[model samples]
Target: MNVEVIIVLVALVGMLAALIMDKMRPGMILFSVVVLFLCTGILSPKEMLEGFSNKGMITVAMLFLVSEGIRQSGALTQVIKKLLPQEKTSVFKAQIRMLPSIAFISAFLNNTPVVVIFAPIIKRWASSVKLPATYFLIPLSYVTILGGICTLIGTSTNLVVHSMIQEAGLKGFSMFELGKVGVFIAIAGIIYLFLFSSKLLPSDRPETSGNEEEEQNSTLHLVEAVIGPRFPGINKRVGDFNFKRHYGAEIKELRRSGHTYTDLGNIRFREGDTLVVLTDDSFIRTWGESSVFLMLANGKDYEPAGKKKRWFALILLLIMIIGATIGELPAIQRLLPEGIKLDMFFFVSITTVIMAWTKIFPPQKYTKYISWDILITIACAFAISKAMENSGVADLLASYIIGLSHSHGPYVLLAAMFIITNIFTELITNNAAAALSFPLALSISQQLGVSPMPFFVVICMAASASFSTPIGYQTNLIVQGIGNYKFTDFVRIGLPLNIITFLISVFVIPQIWSF
Candidate 1:
């Protein structure tokens, strides 16, 4: 290989190491690598920054506003109250009643906010019925994840992958195109959870040092926080970091991967480790905006601030989905120029503006609602994919995989791609994992002399199927802290579902899309 290719491969290795090591945020890590490639003249400035203006990137941004508007309007919360019967006490009965609806709603909304709105409500309901919140919280997160895979806007990862497809000069996914394989995966996942989650999920909540009376008070915040790259306590043992003094928060528990640590004195802070913490209302003001925590679940649901505009927000969202889906029809495509056409980007942009104009969600706070870290990670992903292509690293890796799997057939290759992407997703952000895998999948398709569509669909499924680990998906992390779950809890419940999705996606994807 040439020196340029060698440099690119070396840089990729370093980037992967940093990401897996959890030394920095995925966005920053990716952006830094793209910058390195730019400075080395491997990628031009325009190529480096192209992701910023990408249709998928921008669509995700707009959807955030749309989701925010719906969330702020209180429509979903209203629907939840009406659909979930307060009298239900049995775990199986409750899940059967709730999970399908959760999945359906999550299919339309963002996964994080869906969990955000539903988690506390479900927890309160469980407490009233004398049921462990643990049983429902993990399932809630799982269902949302399953639901997210069913639609393009369901998860940001799908949109990121779709954007990469268009950039690669392929026909991008429609609004419901992913639903083909995704719906099947969702059904299999939900069934697995329904059949097995009760035994797998933890039934007891984590105990705190506080008295029963103190625990009963809602004012005593029980929250979960993930250490971010900028967290000051990185590499420092819990006893050394004096969290109570520094942030006025007590670390009740620390969980990394599948292991739970109660002996905080010896535990060092690491990125992606979930910490169940106890603090008060002031914690939101102090650390809400800090990058030190990738996520914080305060275990309190805010009342809908724009309750009056609920119907308006819901209507706008529905219109956006329907309008975008219809805009992709052949008749619609015929009317527009080859270069210009109405798609999700157009509908989402219009909906976001209407929401802002009507004050469904304050336009002033629009930027705050959008997760810049995720957007940056996605934007940098495009540059990283370009660097891989320009360096011939993608082709090189493709050749090796093709040689090894030539006899095993493309089905084996599909399974391998799914496993790699799934593993990467568990270790890093889903969108980042999808971005890194897209170029390789395309190259593998080229090497096999088959359609790349199956590879792309597998990448989408694998990246989103992060059931085995809390850190694999953001929604899982959120529920991990809120539910006071141990690392084993996820593995117990999520592994089977992970396998179920793996099997269904691998067998069914090629059949539908053809390789």
Candidate 2:
């Protein structure tokens, strides 16, 4: 390898270590590493910044607003209420009643908000019915993830991969193209959950299920608080911050990057650190809207979407999906010029503006809903991937893989791609994992002298099937906090599902998108 290739390889390793170690945010780490590569003359500024303006990245931003409108409109709430069993009996029966609807809803909406809205409600419902909240919360997150993989817009990761495909000068994914394999994966995941979750998942809540009376009487609550720009404790050590005096909350654990820290004394406060606090309900009422904190989990009530507005939001969502899917048909696509054809980006942009104009979600507060860190990570990923290509790192790696797996056929290469992407997703964000893997996947296809379709599909499945750990996906993190689960809890429940997805995806993707 050349000096530049070696440097890029070393930088890649360090980036992974930092992300897994939780020393800094993934975006920050990735951006910093790419900058170093740029400084060494490996990547041009244009290539580095291309991802920032990518249709995929912008689509994710627009979808955040769209999801917010649906969330604030209370449309999903009505649907969920109808779907949940009125009287829950056993964990298995409740799951049978609840998980499918959750998956269906999540397939359309963003998974994070779906979990955010459902976790507490399911907890409360499980409590009222005298069943364990733990049984339902993790499955709720998993099903949403499964559902997300079913459509092009189901998760930001799919969109990012599609964007990469387009950037490579290939025809991008149709709206439901991924659903060919994704729907099957979702069905398989649901089956796995129904068969094994009751036995493997925790049967009791760490605390009393979301009972108001019990919550009111309890001396402490495990609440999550996001540090806002206005937080005064920034740059101060946790021990010196006097959190109890300023916010009336005591920190029990701190989650940054993907690592959880309990050693508050030595850690410095930073914006975006999710502090798991031990506080009472009163703390929520008192500081719920304070500028010092961006968001307080389980604190504020979501205003139900007004009657007329709720229907409007749901209709707008359907229009985006249906219009985009129909627009991609050969007949309709032929009508429009290739340069400006109707696509998911077009539909999503129009839907967002209409929703904003109608005030489905407050337009002024739209930026808060976007996950800026994820966007930054994705944008930087494009640069890093470009660096890998330019510096010969991707080619070098592809040569080794081809040498080792040539005897086993392209299936081995596809399996390797899936395994690497899934491991990266577990360590970092799904979008970032997809970004990093795409160039290498393309290189492998070129090396093997076959179609790249199966490789592309593998990246989508592997990057999004992050079921082995809470840090693998954001939805997992949200559910972990709400369910009060330990690390092993995920391993016990998720490993089998991961294996099932692996088998299904590896076996099915090649058949449909043949090499």
Candidate 3:
């Protein structure tokens, strides 16, 4: 009924509308909501800016730099190569066996890089072993999501939620807290995948029953075409390209930033279109030298120049994680003194600087690895959470939920928070979702007069349980295009997985932590 309450409600509705309609990008939508509410006197200017300076925000930014160091080190490449099943194993069996390795690697390294390394390898393996690449594609995405839930730094969403909780004056979660439940979910999903995965997964790859079959579908030629500014191809229809005569290439797919032009006939080919072709090494070399394609002229194969010390990078990464974990415990934290403490930022910064010293990325290029857009997005999310709290809208929403939850007890409240966070993760980036829900979680805990830790855990899990849609997680979008999957394929596989996560969270959370 109050004007401030009405303003907050209007802002909330606008944010949801923007997410649903895919209007301005997610961070922009949330930033607009915060600015508009602040200018209207719903939230104080200080509240609007509080999120930008939070320790959580800084930690997430630094961890991105750490992720970059690991990526540039060439450590993961060797591990990934070893993960592919050897020649004697059946393709289906190989995928099932590799699930644990895939999930565990994703737990430590960034999932995006893991998939980039594995996609083409799996495609080639599927051909050699006579199996469909599709079987492994969905499982790859699922395992990555499961793995991200296991650690504090596994996903940006976890860091975002951790930051919001600290901003609200609560302790953030431990590294392995979610692992207790997340590992269990992963095991169950992996078992289900192994049992029914081969059947549920489609067989789209070229099936080879014998030598005759091999020759019939003999490997496609690799073609690389450069976009000449004055060429007729620029701004012309893709179907109009004289591929058969001029290039002798079939356009498998075209990537333009985040979008894909899979069905080439309907797409208009523009300059700088990076086409994924299936050609030979000689042609690929020629194309690469001529600037026909920006990258990947050597086909989807790894030809490293030198041997790698995979163990060194792996040990360093583990040391950083272990150091950060031990530093967070009460017993050890007490001895260090007031000024000294281990947060994501400190550990990540130390690790990145050390890695640079070791020439992982040559400190100069380290700046290139950071994703500035994501950092900006995180800072803005903090501002939005503060706006909601000051507007008193979060309080009103919290009270209504509390009254409803009295009958069902804290379990209902925990589940509700988790589901709401998951919905937000699906609708917007995970950082924005965690930001938008922080005030509500804090408000709910206050109304119930309980520790806010359980609610914080809820946000952590929900933000990472983003497997239902491609838009929900960046990893999903990467795999969807690589595998040539339909939208409905994701919906069918992901819906059941989401429901399973929901059910597990509802049952296991209250038992593990106080509600």
The lDDT leader among the candidates is: 1
All candidates' lDDT scores? 0.84, 0.83, 0.69
**Order by TM-score, highest first:** 1, 2, 3
Question: Whose lDDT is higher: candidate 2's or candidate 3's?
Answer: 2
Residue 35 of model 1, lDDT score:
93
lDDT of 3 by residue, 18-70 (tens): 87775655667777887887788866778777767767667766666666556
* TM-scores, each model vs. reference: 0.90, 0.89, 0.83
Candidate 2: worst 10 consecutive residues by lDDT?
A: 205-214
Query: In model 3, where do residues sit more than 4 Å from their true spots?
Result: 205-298, 303-309, 403-406
lDDT of residue 249 for candidate 3: 55
Per-residue C-alpha lDDT of model 1 across residues 1-515, encoded as one tens digit per residue: 99878888898889888988777778899999999999888899999989999989998888888887888898988877876678846888888889999999998888877877787787777888888888888999999999999998999999999999989899989889999988888888888888888888777665443445346876776676766656788888888888999888888778765456778898888766778777888886667645667566665665665555887788888898899898899998898887876788988989988899988887886887787888999999999999989888889988888787866878998998999999899888898788779989999988789999999999999999999888777778777766767788888788888899999999999889998
- In candidate 1, stretches whose alpha carbon ends up further than 4 angstroms from where it belongs are 209-301, 305-307, 336-340
lDDT tens per residue, model 2, 105-213: 8888899778777777777777788888888888998999999998898898888889888888898888889999999999999999999887998776444223454
Error of 3 at 402 (Å): 3.9
Q: Rank the candidates by lDDT, best first.
A: 1, 2, 3
- As for lDDT, the candidate ahead, 1 or 2, is 1
